[model samples]
Target: SLTKTSGTSSRSTSQLGRHFHHRTPGNFLDPEVRAFLEENTEVISSGNLTPEIRLRLLTPRCRFWKERADLWPFADPFWAIYWPGGQALSRYILDNPNIVRMGSVLDLGSGCGATAIAAVMSGASHVLANDIDPIAGMAMVINCELNNVNPFPIAIKNITDTKLDKWDLIVLGDMFYDEHLADCLHHWLGKCIKMYGTKVLIGDPGRPQFTGHSIHRQLHKVIEYSLPEPTRRENNGLTSSIVWSYQP
Candidate 1:
């Protein structure tokens, strides 16, 4: 079923779930939402993504962001903007295509699908995106289309509860924002490493929840980038972001 993290009514959820049919969300998009996003969001590229990864992203100047609750009373529009970490990671993927060549990749919490699109563009054999927010899930499909991604699919739920192994690589960007979510990721990600030796990559700008986790001991920096001017402005005054390799 389409996961509902907010107070949206069951009737409303049923209306939404009919598009997904009680499974991980795929390419299905409600026409109203497709039209709304196409109308409200702006087409732009992320920080330093060479060859230009275009995305339909929301800005504060948009109507929905300026008056969110009044305009769209669902979840916060986390997917509307590409987070700083995701931006840096997407650039890294474009610069270092060999890392994901012919591999299966999962872009966990793939808000805006920037990193996922990079994986596709970089030669990944297959790529799947996962995010809990249904709206974010829809936006990712639109983004993949914006980037001309190959037949993209998104699993629209929190998947941290599963052992979740077998991915050739799993990537996360700016996902370490919540305490409980951080702990769950620590346990689940550690098992993925120890049990399957799956490669993991993290892109972050030192969110407080990051260093406090057990996952901290396993990460080492691979590359860091100074944030582009526009990304810096939105990243809570952070000047840079880092991509860390996880080897357990």
Candidate 2:
């Protein structure tokens, strides 16, 4: 029942099928995926980010358990839940539309495409939402369509894997979860700055990787927010977030 991509193994295909119900190369335009998104997520006005625009997002019932790879399709729906970091960035973009006006924007780790969609709404000339997970990419597309934004593309891979020379602005949201990733981001973003003069912005909810010694050292805080609460009780206490300008 699983369909295979060009280089993917049979096992990987089976797992992807389980997530997209056997639709190989499933994209945001897939009718099945659109229906699934409609059933799994709720379309609502962003409570804290940009209350003016409605987005399709996950609620508490989605069970976003990020550690369980086996439950990747259902339980670990990171793309569904609107993290505090994303909320902060989305709000910042909306409130300061001029920041992205007429610019080319890239939203790395673009969960549900909130920031990318916000960038489009903010009058960016071009927007790309990139995520490591294929499901997240599809989710971004679906969210963009739900928000009535068009021409926004989703890339399912690491930002470093792509050619970033053409991009004018880079936005990262809640991506500083792991040490290795933070390290990689630090080096890659530094190169992006020196080589391309790309303006970088980051949104985080005080993730461990965004510590005082890590990415935080290079970030200048721009704005703070009381974002929407996570569904999980343990993650509930952390309601504050910050938007930072990356001086890489």
Candidate 3:
């Protein structure tokens, strides 16, 4: 039942393999992108969350240049860093393996691939790391290789429109950033649960879109984690995060 009936997934994964040059590490995606990451990032095993995985994340010294300014605001450079919501979600899944074990997981808005990596490490049968940004997908691929985990499939497109009924679970970390996106996910995910009984887990550090409205009432707080020093710094001093089981 975890099988992807959507034909788009196959093509999306294929697109990730296109134009792959000689690899610096892992499957070659883009030589220039890989070079940028290699020069700017270091492989980190963030034991604060999932000690079993590693990621190639940006260094504090890495400069954000004018060339990439176009990507700002929309395709945020924030993907280069792990946020508080993702850190807590990853840790929860790792600690509670029965939640995702042998399940099909979709990590939506999967910045830095932290949630997807945790799902794989926790024994998910099928895990898809999805983001509209191809760079994030590439980053996910590299992280998978660094962890020496199973193959990671990525969908380099927006999936918020889809019902995603076939997936056993959908894990969203720090997704409620704006009202429009929040509305879309609230509708889409609510339908998924009603139609196919898809389970949803949301990790949030109290964004307005999540906590500022009635949507907060629908969520059942499952667990909470006090973010590590680094995560707090990246996330505007959010001291802690809560993992909520979305009961829409």
Candidate 4:
């Protein structure tokens, strides 16, 4: 059975009332985080990939700084944007349902849970959408609701020590933005494949740090899409991206 973190799922209807609840005395859990995203972003279909589902995203006019000042610097709303890499992977899964259907799936660094939602929609038996950022987790929960899909478990922590054996398929979306992060994922994902037979898939917008020889040797492009200018600017002007199946 797929390992699950009990009671932490943001899917429960009961938790909807506590969206603005206080996690600490002075540190409220961005009570307005979901509302801010809904207000600022427009709901639209994902780029070529699962265009049937709606995603809440930031447009060029919506400034990230428009949010509360206290939440500034720490609040990275990238999850609110749909990147090319994620769109590619999601599209691939939809086109190839057997790859995830009836299997346990994990969406690592699952910002906004777009890939995770795709996995679930494709008939995955169980799914875990994990992100170290709590804000991102909130975005995932809300996004799931917008898409009218059941929210998967959202793990808000570094998942290096996770029970790898529990997952059959792992989907990583646009996580190779930094060299250190790229190196860590390269080593850890390789170990997951070697130790267990975990199938690893990745979506990248051609990052400089993503030079993993092992992955590149077996990497085959799955799909590609032309990202809008605003989205391109966010990704350093990279207009297109590829989804690849890692044969480690």
Candidate 5:
């Protein structure tokens, strides 16, 4: 006869033990998301945005990874809001060459690490890629590897807690969209530049708050590119790339 197991014995034998277990959904990738990924995989691998801009349908995967919330990264599809801006910023920085030299640089709201990769390529001694989304952090790691750049990942809850290591430059790309975020970021940026002597560079496509800021220099301007019908959202077709610099 088999030995009878007590309730305590059964509970102790189970993996859950005394704790309760909740079942969550697996695989967040939907059909649309998968299709978008498949379409842009090649373009992302190539690191070329010209064709993408012309096509206007290159959906970038920049979505936040919910499962890895601890990492705090931004998650969106590729070619989403920031990818184009990031590419434009990189191109402008490459063309100028004087703005980003060998120095400590930080890419705030790094997203998929496009600007950070550009910074590394532009000869920054060290690049810190920061984001509050774990998915974006993962993408940053992948993108950095693709571009042959090793970026330091910093998950920050707020810009106030950003490390004050006397960085030479801080790049903000497509971050000034909302009033609240823009205001908070602007305040932090002022502190970063005025107190730390860090050169603040911002890349925006004529967002509301972007216009409000007092810029020291407008370094470069890129023509607005139209997005494909499927991917076109608000301000999709009409957008101008502007690189503004501030020194405090």
Candidate 6:
């Protein structure tokens, strides 16, 4: 079972309500995702409800992967919210199959293991999926199995941890929004890439922090994504996205 964090009064209690209230273009959760949640209903309802639980319960039901069936069993809501780029990157890798053949890959901030699974599907020799969120790690393990890929080793540790190993390719998905995270990831990614001859492949939806990286490939696939209606945040509509890959 997943652990839950304590919630403060400031947090809203409108998740189920928000899920049903919105009727935007990409509002409904994916059917397969919904099925996965329903299958795991017992686990989700077993513990004290918290933000993490709510997020996990909703993750497998989000419609961010309307364009890609390969991303089934979605892992994290924060990452799923920008899955267009992940699908685009996966498509790009599939098209250019040689880039991933037998390469050792590391998925940093691998929320839900979509990118890592995609890498393995595209021919990566080995993959290491790492995330700071324990639930996210569990999701990755489960999702990989669901996708028929061998469950790669998962580390529930931050990218900036003192004990870190190198890989031939580092795949980063939707982790560039926060300035601090982007900065720390950039530094560590550079070190890993340089030391291991690794290629850094990133999938981002044009967030501000994605500006300074040296881009090798930019895919122009515009995928429509539905935002979770309950968040009540800005940008809850359809948006265009891109997949940017680079070698540092």
**Comparing 3 and 5 on TM-score, the stronger one:** 3
Candidate 4 lDDT over residue span 9-66, tens digit each? 2322234324443242222136566565666667777334567767776654565425
Model 6: runs farther than 4 Å from truth?
1-82, 212-235
Q: Which residue pairs in candidate 2 have backbone atoms (N, alpha carbon, C) closer than 3 angstroms, thus clashing?
A: none
lDDT of 5 by residue, 1-248 (tens): 00111111111223332121121112222343334333443333333432222112223343322223222111223322344455556666666556777788888777667777777677777777776544344455545555566646555334556565677888877776556666677667777777778887776656555566544233334334333332223345433455666553
Off by over 4 Å in 2: 1-16, 19-26, 61-75, 228-234
- How would the candidate models be sorted by lDDT, starting from the highest? 1, 3, 2, 4, 6, 5
Candidate 2: 10-residue stretch with minimal lDDT: 1-10
lDDT of 6 by residue, 1-248 (tens): 11111111121234542342232313223444345444543222112111122113333344432324323333223432324445445555656657778888887777656667777888989888877644455556556555677778777666576755767777776666656666677777767766776677776656555655333223223333333333212233325445554644
RMSD of each: 4.6, 5.7, 7.8, 7.9, 13.3, 12.3
How much lDDT does each candidate structure score? 0.75, 0.72, 0.73, 0.70, 0.52, 0.52
Q: Pairing residues by index, what is the TM-score of model 5?
A: 0.63
Q: Give the runs in model 3 whose Cα sits over 4 Å from its true position.
A: 1-28, 65-74
| Lowest summed lDDT window (length 10), candidate 5 | 1-10
Clashes of each: 0, 0, 0, 0, 21, 0
Residue 145 displacement in candidate 6 (angstroms): 2.6
Q: At residue 31, give the lDDT of candidate 2.
A: 73
**Model 1 ranges off by over 4 Å:** 1-27, 46-51, 68-70
Candidate 5 lDDT (Cα, whole model)?
Answer: 0.52
Residue 107 lDDT in candidate 5: 84
Please report the candidate that would top lDDT against the real structure. 1
lDDT string, candidate 3, 1-248, tens digits? 01111112221223323433223333337767777667666777763465566777765555543234432322344567676678889999988888999999989888788899889889999998887667676788788778787658888767776536478999998878777777788888888888889899999888766798567889999998887776666556678888999896
